[model samples]
Target: MRLPKTAHTSRPWRIHEIAGDFQVEDVWALPTPGGPDDLAHLVDQFAQGKGEPIDSPVARALFAIRWKLGALFGWDKPDGGVGGRLTSLRGRLPADLREGPKGPDLTAAPFTSVFQTHDEWAAEMGNRTVHGVMHIGWVPDGAGGYRGQMAVLVKPNGRLGALYMLGIKPFRYLGVYPALIREIGSEWRARAGQRAAGSAGAAGAGG
Candidate 1:
């Protein structure tokens, strides 16, 4: 999460947000053709900072155990294409991103082609060109089709960042990402609620 002392060009989509004790600064240079102007709204929304990506109890619980399943066993890799891809990215992946959602999807693939360091991630994406979002649900939607991949910017506290699609592939979204997102978000939210309740209970008992 620590950034290198060497200064690199700040991304146009940079955002600053504080989550608990963790201060987050994220940047993504997506290959979309819309250019920097394309992200004005995203930056504004994230800056306003309403949604707590990690605040929900569901996400917290899911995120807590996710590393175990997704990282160690790699069962989280939908089609099993990415189980071993991570080992090859050792020096290539910066610590901030060394651990993340790994998968066969373009967004989570072993941090290889996209980048190794934060600077590289930003530099590589600068002015890059790629086939734009093309279609929403490319594979098909909930039934055999993907739930459409949408480009979103993510910033984990402490400079971890990326502008990538929340890719929901055929059955991947409905069968996979959607389920996981809800499951994790739900679990995380519940845990946070429990923590709040515990604190309140302790206060009442003391009173």
Candidate 2:
């Protein structure tokens, strides 16, 4: 579900430190709910799964079209990405975060892991239009269990970036995000079902 910006800004997230130049583009409550330690499952699935739930047919087609246009326009060249046209946020990490788990390696994905803790994970992706951060935090639902909260932060490249963001606003809000949320919910439930089945099997063995 879409959430107010405060849902993210109110928290003392490490992202706040580096993303001051970026804006909170969107925030949503992820469907994944579990104990604090279970956050790893969500992060791992996102990082390792080759075909993520967010990559539905329409989304994939949109992305393919975008990439083709990017290639044609020189928008996605290496120089326009991390460590070339843009510097990575990793350089700004404090010593502790630098030394700690830098989340998952996502060579196969568009994003690169920035940092992670028991309750939080962040990754970054960029092209000519924008440098964006995807942050997930395990937040208390006020009923004792924890659910994931996702926030997107972006630093636009220039006037082009601003215009690009404006152009995609409708599609992002109306289609992409909602589909992604449903996918996350499906994956979350699937994991829960697997755990329940395993537990049932264990109980039968004990009996």
Candidate 3:
């Protein structure tokens, strides 16, 4: 569910310190509800490319068109990515965050993990369009449990980046984000079921 901007901005997230210059592009109430410790699990699943793929046929078509357009326009080349045309936020991390666990290594995803604290995890990605941060936070649901919240922060590169962001805004909100959220919810339910089955097996063995 798309959340109000204040859902992220009103909080005391560490991301606010470093990403002051970036715009809060989107905030969403993730469907992965669980205990506090499950934040890391969610982060791991994301880093491993578990639910990031575009599953909807329309979304997949859009992705295909976008990638083709990127290739034609040299939008996703190495020269347009982090450490080339753009700088990584890792260079701006304080000493403590720099030396701490930088979360998991991504294999097939565009994002690379930045930092993983107790209740938060962040990853970063950059392309010709924009340099963006994906932040996952664990927030209490007032029922003695917690749920996941996600915020997208982006610093658009230049005129091209700004235009690109504007172009994709509608597709993202209507097609891509919805598909991705549904996939994440499905994966979370599957994982929860597996854990329950494992626990039941152990209990039966003990009995």
Candidate 4:
């Protein structure tokens, strides 16, 4: 993915993809290692124990949500894209794609796959290609404060890809992200729990 380097703590997020839907839960990194196996494992596990398709409505909904995410967060351009018709948006997307039904190929394939797939997505959108770059954020360890975390990504024009790499694993559904946020916030508040009491006693005795 070769994302632009930014302060890890800049754009943060808690993973909210899967938990009850699947396993292999963990934070996602840009350009994840061992592309093929890592990706195939997701679909493989989805069918384990039960059967193909996993028999999970939530999983299906999650997939469908990320598959076509334009409805979640509004697009960049309000008028819609070209001449303010259907393909009119605020910014342009990555290059190489041009035409309708051509959207970001969240497929585990190489960048070329994304280009080819989005070409069709553009065509379907009245020949107006998208304009944006791959966006992913990370959490950096903060000094004198709790640790940090971040969002998997912000798709082009908020258009989520077909394969949600985050959902490949489960545990995220239990609200891992929300928990993280609360944890961090608690750390910043008045420490009144046993741990804080222990710390105070230790400091008093110079231990």
Q: Please give, for residues 1-207, the per-residue lDDT of candidate 3 as tens digits.
A: 999989999999878877789999999988988877778778866866644365799888888899999999988999888888878888888888889989985665688887888898888888888999999999997788898999999999889889999999999988899998888888788789765686679789999
Candidate 1 lDDT tens digits, 75-178 = 33534322232212223444555564222212321222222122112111111111111101011223432211122222221221122222212333334344
For model 4, the run of ten residues with the poorest summed lDDT: 118-127
Best-fitting candidate, measured by TM-score?
3
List where candidate 1 sits over 4 angstroms from the true fold: 1-86, 93-168, 197-207
Q: For candidate 4, write residues 1-207 as lDDT tens digits.
A: 112324322232111121111121123232212212122222212113122122345554554664355445543244554345432221233332223223332332111111112001111121122322221222223332222222232222222322333443353444333343343334324223544575568789996
Task: Please identify model 2 stretches exceeding 4 Å from their true place.
Answer: 193-207
- For each candidate, C-alpha RMSD in Å? 17.7, 3.3, 2.9, 18.2
The regions of model 3 sitting more than 4 angstroms off are 50-52, 194-207
Question: Per-candidate TM vs. native?
Answer: 0.23, 0.89, 0.91, 0.21
Ranking by TM-score: 3, 2, 1, 4
Q: Is candidate 1 or candidate 3 better by lDDT?
A: 3
**For each candidate, what is the lDDT?**
0.28, 0.85, 0.85, 0.29
Model 4 regions more than 4 Å off = 1-5, 9-176, 183-191
Superposed Cα deviation of residue 109, candidate 2 (Å): 3.0
